[model samples]
Target: MTSDCLFCRIVAGEIPATVVHETDATLAFRDIAPKAPVHVLVVPKAHYADVAELAKADPALAGQVLAAGAAVADAEGLTQDGFRVIFNAGEHGGQEVFHVHAHVLGGRPLGPMVSS
Candidate 1:
């Protein structure tokens, strides 16, 4: 875990977050600033700068992250109606935090995937 990464700090207990789900390999928490009614961030306990990095370093862990996000959606009752799991990459992808995280969003209708 990177000492300076925010998600790493949260995983390390140096920071506090409203965690919703956790496992040996992943942690799912509510987003501080919600974009939807049910917006949660699912991340691997071990740090990865981005999704590409995570997938390259540990594909199993990357799959676990996806599973964890799905689990979060299930727990939040987003499975039936559908939900969105997003992994923003660099600055152009709107990734504010360097750590790889999947944003599980639901609880309402989401419009277009991207706006022009």
Candidate 2:
């Protein structure tokens, strides 16, 4: 785990987080700045700068991340109603944390992916 990565710290147990689901390769936790009632971030325990990098480095692990996000949606009771999983790429893509993670949002109707 990278010492400077927030998600890495959370994965390492160096920091406390409201973890909801965990898998061999992933971790799911509540978002501190939630956009939806059931907002969670599903991340790979091993740090990767972004999704592209993660996908390139370990495709299987990347798949695990996706699975973990879906699992989080199921655990949060959002599966029946549906949920959104988002992966913002770089700075322009709205990724604040460098580590790769998927935002699982639900519990209410979401806005359009893009507003015009």
- The candidate 1 region of ten consecutive residues with least summed lDDT is 107-116
**Error at 74, model 2, angstroms:** 0.8
Which digits, one per residue and each the tens of the lDDT, describe model 2 over residues 1-116? 99999999999999999999998889999999898898899999999999999999999999999999888988889999888999999999999999999999999888786221
lDDT of 1: 0.94
Q: Cα RMSD (Å) between model 1 and the true structure?
A: 1.7
Could you tell me how far off, in angstroms, the CA of residue 107 lies in candidate 2 after the best superposition?
A: 0.2
Q: Could you say which candidate leads in lDDT?
A: 1
Please report the TM-score between candidate 2 and the true structure.
Answer: 0.95
Cα lDDT tens digits, model 1, 1-116, are 89989999999999999999999999999999888999999999998999999999999999999999989999999999999999999999899999999999999889877322
lDDT of each: 0.94, 0.92
Worst 10 residues of 2 by lDDT: 107-116
